[model samples]
Every structure is written in structure tokens, then in C-alpha cells.
Target: MAEQTFDVHVEREFDAPIERVWAAWTTPDDLRAWWGPTGFSCPRAEVDIREGGSIFVTMRAPDEWGGGEYHSVWEITELDEPVLLRYIYRFTDADRNVITPAESGVPAEGIPDEAHHEVLLTAVGDGRTRLEMTEHGYTNEQTRDMSRSGLDQCLDKMAEVVSAQPR
Candidate 1:
């Protein structure tokens, strides 16, 4: 069988320059204001913003997914100011336990130390920036399907976040 692949790319023109766009991502306070899907607010924000830094955030929506929802903690593996932010993001439970692949029924041995996720930000000049996000690594077709769908929602949320930012 062929190796399964999972990738997602999202792009948009922001009314702000690359510097501001970069700030929106690196600064915890700024990021809290506009991160994740629309209407899902972040009540807590923690970010190291460097190579191997840690980022933990809680996404809260009044009536989203039947109630507030949370995304697993993400570890920053590579950070290049105003350009790249790469990390492994895992989906977890409230207790912070890595949900097992058996639980998801995808033969995942729990979220691995490395999961496929990376963000690329490029300055397109003229005060506009293009953001491309790619999620990699899915050994199975089923897992790839799930990753594709989820990433669509994530990009939609990202569009909202970028649009909401001040120029």
C-alpha cells in the first residue's frame, strides 16, 4: 500500500504588514484575542515563542461543539521570527492525557512525540502577507481523511483570526 499523506494549505491577504502579523502570532496577549475558530475565545494564553518553546491554550465557545472545546497542547519545535512556526500539536483530553490511537481507533500509539503540523508565513510586500499552513504525517487513509477535514475547520478559524486583526 502507498504511504498515506496528510497536508493542508491556507492562504489569505492580511491588511497588516508582516511585522504586525508576526506579532499577532508571537505575543500571547495578541494571540489570545484572535486564535482558533471564530467565536472560540482563549481564556488562557502561554507561549515561549522560541525554539522548543511550549504553547498551551484553552479555547472556549459559549455553545460550540455542545460547549467549550479545547485543542491539545502544542510544542514549538522550530521558530523563525516573522516567517515560520512549526510544531507538533496533539489532540488531548481535559486531564492532558494524550488520547490513544486505540481510542480514536486509528492504531495511533497515542499522539507521538512528533505529529505532522507546520505553519509558514511569508511577506508578500505592500502590507500584505500570505500564510500557508501544512499538516503532515498520517500513516493511514482514515487518519488522513480526519486530518484533512479538521484542518479545513482550523483554516476557517484562522481566516477569521486574521480578518479580525487590526491593520
Candidate 2:
């Protein structure tokens, strides 16, 4: 398999500089404030914002659906401050426990070393940053279908998080 994957792309024109936008991502407090969809909040977070660092967070819904914990262990493969950040993200529990492919619904055959995840933050003209994030290694048809339905809402939340922040 050619590393089947699903991607979510979000581009927003912010009235902020690239450095400030980068801070929104690298700073733990700023990240927690706007990491998810609108109205959702992260009451807990632990992160080390450096190469080979990790980030763990719990997303809580404002409504009564309750909230589940999810985590991603990232190794900053490439970092060009305020320009780009490339990393591998894996699913995990609230405690930053890694979850295997079987548990993550990804078949072993499709998993690639670069299949975890790739998030690219680029400085588009007009003072905007284009954020492209992808979650790969999920070749299973059912899992992909299920995730597709929820992705837009998730990205919307992420955008909302960014919008709510002050430059």
C-alpha cells in the first residue's frame, strides 16, 4: 500500500505576524486555548515544545456529550521557527500512552515510518498562514469513512480556537 491517508487543510487570513502565529502553536498555554473546535476547551495539557517534544491534551465539549482524551507524541523532524514544523503524531490516551495500529484501526501493512501525521504551517501572502494537517496510515475503509464525517467539525473548532486568540 502507498500509505493511505486522509488530510485536513485549513487556511485563514490572520492579522498577526508569522512569529505570533507560531507562538500560538508552540506555546503550551496558547495551544491549549485554541487547539480544538469552537466552544470546546482543553482543561488539561502537558507539552514540551522542542525537537523530540510531546503534547498531550483532553478536549471537553461544552455540551453534555462528555469528552474523551486523546494524545499525540511528536518528534519535531523539522523546525524552521515561524515558518514550518514537521512532526510525527500518534494516537494516545490522556496520559500520553501510545496506541497501536490495531487499536487505532490502521492495518499493520499500511503503516509507514512517515505515516503518523504531517502538519505544515506555511506563511501565505497577505499575512495569513495556511495550515495543512494530515493523519495517515488508515487504509481501512470504515475508519476513513467515520473520520471524514467528523473532520470538518474538528477543523472548524481549530479555526475557532485561533480566531478567539488576541494577536
Candidate 3:
């Protein structure tokens, strides 16, 4: 029997420095500004941010889109200054209790829970940062695509947020 794997990888270039890009992900205020997709709003942001710590976000959908909050926790596995980060993404309840994909209204197959993620950053010239995000181990195609779309939008918003900040 072969195990199935679905993965997502997205890359973006920011006009800001690698430190700015890293701050967008690590700072709670910056995270709250652009944590979700285009139509989604982030209402809550909390972080510990060390190698064994976690980042938590409450992503709120718009009222017109059937308002709901999706809570997520990223358990940090590795932290390397402004260049790299590794974490495990998980759905969680309001109290930050981990939930399975099914419990989170995700239609998953052949997997119980969790996705491993890595964020890589490189300085391009003096004031640009090339960023890459990789998420591995989705259970199915549909789930992977849905996640990818959200991630893309999040990065899009991140670029905007970082660009607006003074370098």
C-alpha cells in the first residue's frame, strides 16, 4: 500500500528587507493585519515565537460570507533569525485545543491531522526579500487546493502590509 501526500509551495518577492518580511510573520500586530485571505479578517493574534512555542490566530469570515471564526495554531519547530521558520499547522478550538481535520470541517482522506510548514527567506540585493512557503501532508487534492488559495491570499496581503511599512 502506498501512502498519499499532497503538498503546497508558494513563493513571493517583497520589496522590503528580509527582516521586515520576518516581522510580518512574527509580530502579533502585523499578523493581525494580514493573517487570512482577502475577504477574511483576523480578530485575534497571539504568539510565543520560540522554537518550542506557538502562534495562534483567529480568522474571522465576513458577515456576508456566513460569519465564523477559524482558529489556528502553528507550533514552532525551528526558528532561525530572519531567514527560516518551521512549524506544524493545526486547527484548534477557542481554548487552543487541537482538533482533527474532520472536527475542523475539513474533508480529509487517509490522514488524521496536521500539516508541516516551512518558511524560507533570502535577501535579494539590499532591500528585497525572496520568500518561500511550503506546506506538506494534506490528505487530498481538494483540501490542498483550498489551503493553497488561502495561503496565496495571505501572502498577497502580507506583501501589501509590509510594503506600506517604513523600511
Candidate 4:
């Protein structure tokens, strides 16, 4: 029998150019400005925009959302300027120590040890940019659904951030 796998996908269009949209994602300061859910905040972010690079981000949930910090790292696997980006997401400690989801306050059950993410950017026309994000490797539907919600919220925040950038 085949194993069950779940994935999360979200897409959004912005009024900015592809260059601005790409920079908003790859720049650390821009990431910190709008990396988490609506009520959440990213207090730390470090991005190395190259193949085989790694990114570190610290996200803090609001008091109503458990009020804790979650540290994560994204191991970049592929990169295409202003077009495509791919990485593997994993939890890590503040000091760069790898940790399990349980240690990071993330639900362990139904969550994969490592989630794969792929982001594609396209210029739709008239300086508009379309961003498509996909995250896979979930062990169950519940985890996938949860991630989908988070991703959607993150993009909603991204829309505001990118739209404000000078295009």
C-alpha cells in the first residue's frame, strides 16, 4: 500500500514588480517585517540568498497564540533570481542547535521532521507580481491544514509589506 502524504499550497498577487517582490522575500529586514501570522512577529531573521545557503528566523506568537518563540532554519536547495526558490524547513534552537518539533513547541504528531517548500515568482504584467508558495511532506491532513492557514496569513502580511516597497 502507498503511504499518505499531505501538502499545503497558497498563492497571492501583489501590485509590486517582480524585483521588489523577490527582494522582499530574500532580504532579512524585509522578512522580519512580515514573516509570521497576522498577530505574530518575527524578531530575528538571517537570509543568505544563494544555493546551499541557510536562513534563520525567530518568530514570536502573540499572547493569545501561546506567546512563545519558535526558531527555524531553512536550508536552501535551489535558487533562481526573481523566479524560484526552494528550501527545507526544520526547527532549531536559538544557538543553532537542531531540535525536534516538540522542543520548539510545535505539534509533533502528524508533522514531518522536515517540510519542503517551493516558491515561484512571476510577473503577471503592468508591474504586478504573482507569488505561489507550496509546502509538502506532511504526515497527515491536520498538520497540512494548519500549515496552510499559517502560510496564508503570512502571505496576507507579505502583501502589505511588498506593496509598500518602492517599485
| Candidate 1: tens digits of C-alpha lDDT, residues 16-119 | 67777777777777767766554567776677788878677666765845555564667788888888888887655555566654443334632243575777
Candidate 1 vs 2: which has more lDDT: 1
Residue pairs of candidate 1 with colliding backbone atoms: none
Q: With candidate 3 superimposed using the best TM-score fit, by how many Å does residue 7's alpha carbon deviate from the native?
A: 0.6
Off by over 4 Å in 2: 1-5, 9-12, 61-63, 101-115, 140-155, 158-164
What do the candidate models score in CA lDDT, each in turn? 0.65, 0.59, 0.88, 0.89
**Number of colliding residue pairs in model 2:** 3
Q: After superposition, how far is residue 69 of candidate 2 from its true place, in Å?
A: 2.8
Cα lDDT tens digits for candidate 2, 5-69: 65433344445556667776677777676665556677766767666775666566666645544
For residues 122-143, what per-residue lDDT tens digits would candidate 3 score against the true structure? Answer: 9998699999999998767877
Order the candidate numbers by lDDT, best to worst. Answer: 4, 3, 1, 2
TM-score of candidate 3 relative to the true fold: 0.93
Best by lDDT: 4
Q: Which stretches of candidate 1 lie over 4 Å from their true place?
A: 1-3, 61-64, 93-97, 101-114, 138-167
Clashing pairs in 3: none
Score every model by TM-score: 0.71, 0.68, 0.93, 0.95
- Highest-scoring model, TM-score: 4
